[model samples]
Target: MSNSDPVLLIETVRPDDGRTESFWVALVITGVLLLGGLGILLRQEQTSATDTRPQLDLLQRQFLMELTIAADEIRFITTMNSEVSTDTGFVNWPLEQLLQEQLLPVFPGQSAKAWQQLEPGCLLLPQPASRIHFGLVLQQAGSSIHYAPADVPLPDHCETLLSWQRMDIQS
Candidate 1:
């Protein structure tokens, strides 16, 4: 054939030649492996996402427990005021130890501090005639004991208590 003229030689096609079939098989195997890896990754991510909610829930429960204990401690302090001196009273008791041992262990990284200046009773009462004040005080004390900015007055004490309950549910 001339250099410019195309050769038209007849060649027999054979199915027994291994190279072409092997290449196709390798490509299909590689594709399947990649898809399997992707599926595994997605499943692991889903599992991790599901795990986070329980952790948050455990945190909320621990916080609520801490608040309840602290409220009881406050009540104890108030009750014991006549017998124990203020400096040597229940307020001065090692609350941090109780928190660390009983509550912090549940939450892992939670930290707590009790202040002498703030009393659960103060936040509980607005005036002598406010009959609902005592219940509000108990609720608020339980709510604020675990959260920060304790001085911020709750608009509705009952609502604040409900909010904590909701947080517990969501978590």
Candidate 2:
């Protein structure tokens, strides 16, 4: 053989085996399918998360609005009762008006009652009634809890009360 002979340096190319080629193709296809499935799962989770955020925001806003209205109703009732108690030594007209107008609309199944216990008087003199009592009877029917008198309080003569209560709902 000569040093420069082309036949001495020639390299033959062999065909791939069917089993090996099929194994490699299956592996690549399985890997691609797994990656695609994972990608779809991740995208679905992200979309669900994105959709839930706005719904949560809307629920929070609704709760806040309801709380505000409840606070306003409480304030109006208390202030009207206090005023009438101080003026007439009994809460009669204001209590009736408040119950008929404001309280009925806001708290549908609730009723407001005022009581006056007069002081003991001598034979010729009348004792001044010093205290007035206002009570609210509420019948709550839905999932929401009624705002109690303790739950709603005036803020330094302010007409509104701001408070937060956490609620959980199963989806």
Candidate 3:
């Protein structure tokens, strides 16, 4: 294949047939398919959220029940303990240590920081939500467990609202 030698060149030509129209049609079809797929995914996501609502409600109910039981147990313990002063409720009992050893174990993922003692006899455990500015608070006061969706920040002193549901345990 010397440069000087006569080279036989073959040129291939593409005809401007209806294939160009097919390309645009395919492009439009692809776009429509992609949009449809995305719409389906969005619908499924909405459905999933609605589906989980009932489950979430059920879970909250269960959690509240467990918290009630825990509160009752703590109340009984404090009542029985000689060190604890009944005048000041949980004043003399090792409340933090007690919660760490007992309550925190039942709630696996809850951090110790999440549990706050509003007072000697009162405790506030906030139930966090994904997008809500307000949170539901589980309050344990003496022998009863109370819960409410608190729109306002919890005060230093525990105050029960009339709207709040209190589970009065006969300890």
Best prediction by lDDT: 3
Compared with the true structure, model 2 gives a TM-score of: 0.25
Clashing pairs in 3: none
Order candidates by TM-score, high to low.
Answer: 3, 1, 2
Q: Which candidate do you rate higher for TM-score, 1 or 3?
A: 3
lDDT of 3 by residue, 81-150 (tens): 5445546444354457756666532334656567666655556666565211111223224455555543
RMSD of each: 13.9, 15.1, 15.9
**lDDT per residue as tens, model 2, 1-171:** 887877747789788668888999999999999999999888873434343222224533454355445435544554555533343333233334544564323222223332111211000001112111112221111112122123233222101111212222211
Clashes of 1: 1
Badly placed stretches (over 4 Å) of model 1 are 1-17, 39-153, 165-171
RMSD from true fold, candidate 1: 13.9
> For candidate 3, what is the TM-score?
0.49
Q: What's the number of clashes in each of the models?
A: 1, 0, 0
TM-score of each: 0.31, 0.25, 0.49
At residue 122, candidate 3 shows an lDDT of 59
